[model samples]
Target chain A: MNRTFGEKVFNVFNLLFFLVFSIILLIPILYILQQSVDVGAVKSGLSLWPSDPSTAYYKMVLGDQGIYGPLLNSIYITVVGTTLSVLINAAAAYPMSRRDYKPNKFLVYYIVIIPMLFSGGQIPTFLVLKELGLLNTLAVCFLPVLASGWNIVLIRNYYRSIPESLIEAAKIDGAGEFYIFGRIILPLSKPVIAAISLFTGVGLWNTFTPALMYNSDPTKYTFAVKLREMIVVQEDMSRQFEAMMQQMALSSASGQAMTNEGLSAAMMIISIIPIIIVYPFLQKHFASGLMVGSVKG
Target chain B: MERKLIGKKKGGRLGTTNIVLTLMVLPAVILLTIFHYLPLPGVAIAFAKYNIGGFQEWVGFENFQYIFKLNNFWRAFLNNWMYVALNYVFIFPSSIILAILFNEVRIRPYKKFVQTISTLPHFLSWAVVGGIWMLLLSPSNGYINQIIEALGGEPIYFFANNTTFPLLYTVIAIWKSVGYNSIIYLAALSGIGLELYEAAAIDGAGRWKQTLHITLPGLKPTILVMFVLSFASILNLFEPLYVLSNAMVRESSMVLDTYIFQSGIMQGRYDISTAMGLFKSTISLVLVLASNFLSKRLTEDGQSIL
Candidate 1:
């Protein structure tokens, strides 16, 4: 473990490099956090430091039913979608994982190759949903996410970690395949299940594209779609911001200001905070899941 | 390999395992068929003229012909290649450098902290990341512009500028993905034998010499795999640009994916959009095959970068 002078300098440089880079990465989110709480009529806007801190923006954002609707929708989609995704993919993967399953190669090739290949473009996918009458319904949110080929691959690989004799022993007994799958395979595959659930949960929580393409209704929007909509209306908000800017120019004292940029930041915070809250716990599984999934490939 | 029967249950008619397996795979079969396989037939819609309920007429390649002539399509076409080129020049190497630096950290806890912190953006949806960056890059009051103003320089509106657009695009692309992507290189690094490094150290090789000669060469296959795969994704530059683009920046930012979105959804030119989608998908497959071929050569053991 002894280091030469050059190695010592390199270590110092490496630490500084990460330190500086990590700060560069962090400042935007940190600024957004600080900006969300600053009172709208600060007279001076967009400082690194908040001039005046208050809960006014939070109250205003919280009061709007626009924010709450999508908040609930995103949660509903994520919870339901993640649950169904794990179930469908895991169930499908269970058969593929068993070498004794007659169609394992056929099923794996069909499902796994789809992930490796290009997807049928967004338009056709959209049309399929529209034709199905699933568009603008909450079911649309979960449909595309229902059985991911990637999660199936991950779970199938995880199932390989279980002893082959375990399943054979169940077969030696009177246990049915479903009985063994439910009783043995699933319970043993908790780590991989948790991993896929975390990955799927993050994906569903942040899903914006399907919501954007399929659902025209605001009520059907997820947190991601809602977040974009709030930012997209900056043009409309800009007019109000111009008025506020002029009012600040005129008044020597504090003036009433509408939530413009602050509103979007608050929404951004809302969209991200739930993920942030859950992220630390899931971090280890996320890394291991990715590694396990890719190591064979 | 999968031909073996589990037990002495030899009945071909409705065996318990076969039935259970069929029941298990039914949902995946149904879902994939409906969503994914349908696109194969639905892609035919690209050739068909539009109507309310179904096809109006068979227009052959007219939809493809139309998009080729569109001004917006050309702009996005060039932008896609430009993004691909920039990713090669900028992102591909920096990620490896990051992985190397990360590997160099002697402090375990500190290394883990940096790794975890850097990958934080990967976990969040682009909508949230895009919003944060949009504010940070705002010409009026964004922190970047604030820095420019502090230095007595003019505040540049990054997204709206063609000159700065690519630069910001590259930085944000790297910022969002480098940490997560570097893990691939780190995995490659970890896969190298410790004895090689130990022998090098014993033979009076310094850390730099050891890393340059052993570690980087160990990562060569991975780096090339990433390179070839990314090269194929040049036209695939939709996600990042889709979030950041505005009408003003569409000239610089209109990728094929967004063009498809604009045509099909916004303009109701579903035929043209489907044509574009088919076009993109075909090229993507070609690129994937080419990369797979190249990666098989590099890895020397039939590796697929999927």
Candidate 2:
């Protein structure tokens, strides 16, 4: 393709524009990273370069059981919740996806879609969970979020693309519904399943509202809740640092020299590390899954 | 035996009458009923005096009347619309412009790298994003303020100031979502026919003219659908607002969702809070319906997102 002078100039502008925009976008996380590693006492600027880079903040964060408890809870909920969410939504969606299913329209519209549009609000939902005696339990973390209307919709959308003849053939061969679902439908729907799992996983990993509302026990808190408590709420970090110092048998002078900002930045990085790790590998699936789920909607 | 016979008679279209299929759907239905449908009637708590003992006094709209009288409620209500208006003016078209720019990129690797970095924030929870931004904007030792001090200007307290808080809110909101949101438009852009651009080019159209006449026109339906769908979230400003709000910025940042949370959970005024939730839900429903109606008018086939 032949490019005109104006087009060449525009291309140069666009490339430079994106270069600057990308840097601006990245500066926050990079700054946080720098802060986490910087050992300087009187740091007050945004420099991508760390001064006296040290792993002390990470070590302190890692050593603190306060961080570990929430970390473990977040991981547990994400793994278990994503699995159950995928299974429940997939199972429910399978029936709705069948072209011959009589109640598909009614169920999709009334039972699932209506609720998506008009929610019962937070207080009512909280009250319902309370009535069920689910508050403060690990079940509260995963159970309510297991079957979202959106996930079911996405799964059903993908399932609908599978040919009916495939299921009919399996049925004619004396294969049961469960066998066909397990063998044929599920194996063929890996893309959608992976997509929903990633979506659910990210959602569960980052969930704070559930922990905040349903669990009063500090031990039951997820990483998100703990993070909020530490950073956003500015819950006494000086005491937390003091506790760390005592645990380490470090002198009070060392504790006085260190600020909790570094520790907070370290925790923030730890919280998102899983996401950053899995993000590149799963990036393609996220976009494709969104597109697949968006079809005919 | 009977089930097999029935399946054979209907040529294997068992519908949901199949026991296995019904069983598969049972857990979801049960859970949805407990979590979603059950709380629906509980919205009535907005009208009644709620108690821990499961006793309710029929206050009959007293709660709604009470919240209506509160200055805070009105402020929060106005604040919700303010965010929505700002979103329209800035946040809405940002992704579209971003997608257009992304579409113009000739190099695959640079585009991919930029996209990866830009979309990273969307995966982060509001807690983490908010924490990072707060640190970056902190009045003391924050980078932005540090830069100001270096430049011989006063270090501004971005979050504490009502004026600067909204500006901060808008920038963060855009930064967080622009790349992720642009994916939809980029997908739409890919679907546009290359033949149209080629034909326009043959007809003495420059690259700019081709984009204007062919590319944008092709993306019209998608842009319209997205615009209409955005209305569904007009009042949904809880997460970002909750994470970023400080006491100093409360008057500017108080939104309906957080107001409900503060009043109901923290203050133990569940009744009035439920009333506020009810009001929010009602308006949200209206907005969704209104948007769907608008979508029907906007789309070429008169298709509604609902």
User: Candidate 2, residues B1-306: lDDT per residue as tens digits?
Assistant: 553455556545555346778789888888888888889888888889985555468899898888889999999999888898899899989998898989999799998899898877888998898999988887656788898898999978788898778778999999998988888888888899888888887888997788888878888888777866676666777778998888889999999999988887767677888899989989888887887888788777888777
DockQ of each: 0.56, 0.50
Cα lDDT tens digits for candidate 1, A93-205: 98888766667777876786764575778788888888899889988978866877767877888899898888877877878888999999999988888777877788888
- Which ranges of candidate 2 are over 4 A from the true structure? A42-46, A233-256, A289-297, B1-8, B11-17, B51-54
Superposition-based RMSD of candidate 2 using all C-alpha atoms, in angstroms: 4.5
Q: In model 1, how large is the Cα lDDT of residue A234?
A: 80
lDDT of 1 at B96: 89
Fnat of candidates, each listed: 0.62, 0.65
Specify the poorest-scoring 10-residue window by lDDT in model 2 chain A.
Answer: A288-297
Worst 10 residues of 2 chain B by lDDT: B8-17
Residue pairs with colliding backbones in model 2 are: none
lDDT of each: 0.79, 0.82
Cα RMSD (angstroms) for every candidate in the order listed: 3.0, 4.5
